[model samples]
Target: MIAQRDLARAISAVENGHGSFAQAAATLPETARTAPAYVVGITGPPGAGKSTVVDRLIENFRSAGETVAVIAVDPSSPFTGGAVLGDRVRMQRHAGDRGVFIRSMASREAGGGLAPTAQEAVRLVERAGFDVVLVETVGVGQVELEVVSVADTIVVVTVPALGDGVQTIKAGLTEIADVFVVNMADRPGANRTAVDLTHMVRESGRETPVLQTIASEGQGVDALFAALQSARGGATNAARAVRFEVLRAVRDRAARSALAKLDEPAARAIFASLAAHACTRRQATDALFELFFTGG
Candidate 1:
């Protein structure tokens, strides 16, 4: 078992683009790669008590003799690109638990409601021999669908009474959730919200459970944990997920190249020439390719 300081240092090195984190990850024993660090994604709208839910989950998993690692993604400051609301304040109760490792990450323009490195961090934690890796995302609704790629089970947490019209807006979330938790269930309209979610899940032809909980009080956490354990391998398609990541990386590289060209004088001159000649799409594409690749 890694000591607290060493684990934190390893994760920090990975986040800052230094040290042997990647090397360590690449050299992980085959057994470590397939270890049982069941990654669970807990996501929902802001103020849905996601942090509280995560805290309760840590307690439940620890009680079961499971060591857990958490990568909590918080929105970044637009000005400084630093995490705006770090989880250290919310999850301080676990500060003394050797079984729990918590790391807060800034969602620094990675998009899709996660830090670009979130999945890598999860992999590192898994490779380090944790029993569970919990990824709590920024909870920006449907954009968080990518969490399915990393988490074996996804629990969508929502509070009761999101107002009259918001339920319809969350249909996409309902579809991706393996377990729908209506947190703060002690609040008004808890049953109604649960019933609505149940109907949505039923209509989708899936048997996803809609559970109620008050995470702050640890209510319903044990059942939630059981559901999480039972729901493993529900959303993962390893091959497809790997392909998507590769495609996304290529797309990002292409996008960066195009954006860079937009500010280049040569690209501008080529665009002007193409426009002046009323060039066909293929002709303009060929010219642009030549400008960037063939250096024409």
Candidate 2:
């Protein structure tokens, strides 16, 4: 059995793409592959009560004798190189629960939705024997759509008065949602938002399920769970194969990019050149291209 400290270190190793952790993760048993845990992705615009919904889901999952792991992706503080990790604070009730493993990942400028480290963190949690894994992304535009590729079921949460859900549809998030959730259903425009989402789904010709909930009061959570289960049952093996291909591509790109950043002298030189170029109002891309072709 891996100790908690060791597990934490392993997670960090994987996040950093270190060789030892990669070996360990690869050596994990077939049972790890066959485990019944369902990965759920929760994403939405900031302040859409996503964390509240995740909290409710965690509570419900625990009540049903299931162990749960949560991977909360927080926006990085540029100056600090760290995350405030506010979402984890909201889930402190599960801190002492042995059945729960909650990790907060910093989304450090890996735009287009999730941080590279977030995916590794999920793998760590999944291998730690949790019966379920819930990944909450740093709710940033269409990038959050990346969650759809990783999660077995994605719950796209939205709130009322969000512009007829048109903005979300335009962002392409509405297409990836396996379950659409209109949280804070007590709000005036909540029902309207739900209806609009249903219409949008119908228009897209996809029979996606939408659920309304007052997450704060734990309303309609059971229906959401049921919908998720039904979707899981209907999920085909072919879809999983495609998802695996996408995940492999994502991991490969991230690994290559991480390798490119390890040049200490080159990194310093590049930064210094960029600073000098900025003072002259020159484009950094032009300088980068010149450096690339000239071997400067």
Candidate 3:
């Protein structure tokens, strides 16, 4: 097994785009790259109590004798481009626990509620021999459906008061969520939200599981744990995850190579024009992308 410190370095290299993600990743055993479905994505809108749910899940998993790694994607800082908050604050208690590894990654304005390198980071954690990987997204409204690309089981958490008609929801998160969780169940309309989610899933022709929870109080988490375990027993989309992983890696490298052209004299002229507002950002972006695709 790769050391956790080495795994952390590999993820850092990937996230910063500073080094060869391939070289760093190659330090792991070849088995680490196999089709593995040990990831569980916990995501929802802000204030859905996803962090607390993850904390509780970590506790349960550790108690069940599993080593857990967490990647909590947080909003980025305006100046430093780093995580506004690290390790979910609530999860700091586990800092001393050798069996639990938690990291907070800055989303850096990436869409789909995840950091650009979050998928690769999850794989790095897996390479470190963690039994389970929990990916928590930056809860920015409904754009979190991207979690499906990485996790074997995607748990969508929501609160009780969003009155947006579930029936009117379209081809989005509602259709992709493997499990729906209505957190803060002590609040009013908790059961109502659960029922609405159930009905919505049924309407979509899926028998998805919907559960309610008071994550802060650790209520109903046991049932959720059981449900997650049940998912582990079933077939997973490991083959799909592996395909996306390689595709994304290729695209990421291509983009980086294109960006590197900015230092070339020809590209510098474009940048000069861009700085003088002689051309629009769209023009500059198109120029760079053209260089990448056409080798111009």
Q: Against the true structure, whose lDDT is highest? A: 3
Rate residue 214 of model 2 by lDDT. 91
Q: Candidate 3 on 1-296: residue-level lDDT in tens?
A: 45668778888988888776687678765544444537899988888899999999999999998889999998887577755765468887688888888888888868778888998898788777888999998885754566778888888888887775553265566755778899998999888788878777777787789999999999989989988988884655456557766787798898788777768888888889899999999998888677667877
| TM values, all candidates | 0.80, 0.76, 0.77
- Flag regions of model 3 displaced more than 4 Å: 27-37, 77-82, 236-296
Residue by residue across 1-296, what tens digits does model 1's lDDT show? Answer: 66656666666777777765666565444334454678888888888988888998988888888889999988887788766756657788898888889988888877677776788888778877888998898866656666766877878998888865356345566656778899989999999899888777777677888899998888898889889878765544355467767888888897787777866887787778787987776887887888766667
What digit string (tens of lDDT, one per residue) describes model 2 on residues 172-265?
6776788889998999988888888988889888788888999888898888877866766456323853775678688888667645753656
CA RMSD, predictions in order: 4.3, 6.4, 5.8
Model 1: number of backbone collisions: 0
Q: Residue 206 in model 1: shift from native, Å?
A: 1.2
Clashes of 3: 0
Winning candidate number (TM-score): 1
Worst 10 residues of 3 by lDDT: 28-37
Q: What TM value does model 3 have?
A: 0.77
Output the better candidate (1/3) by lDDT.
Answer: 3
The models' CA-based lDDT, in order, is: 0.78, 0.74, 0.81
Please give the TM-score that candidate 2 achieves against the real structure: 0.76
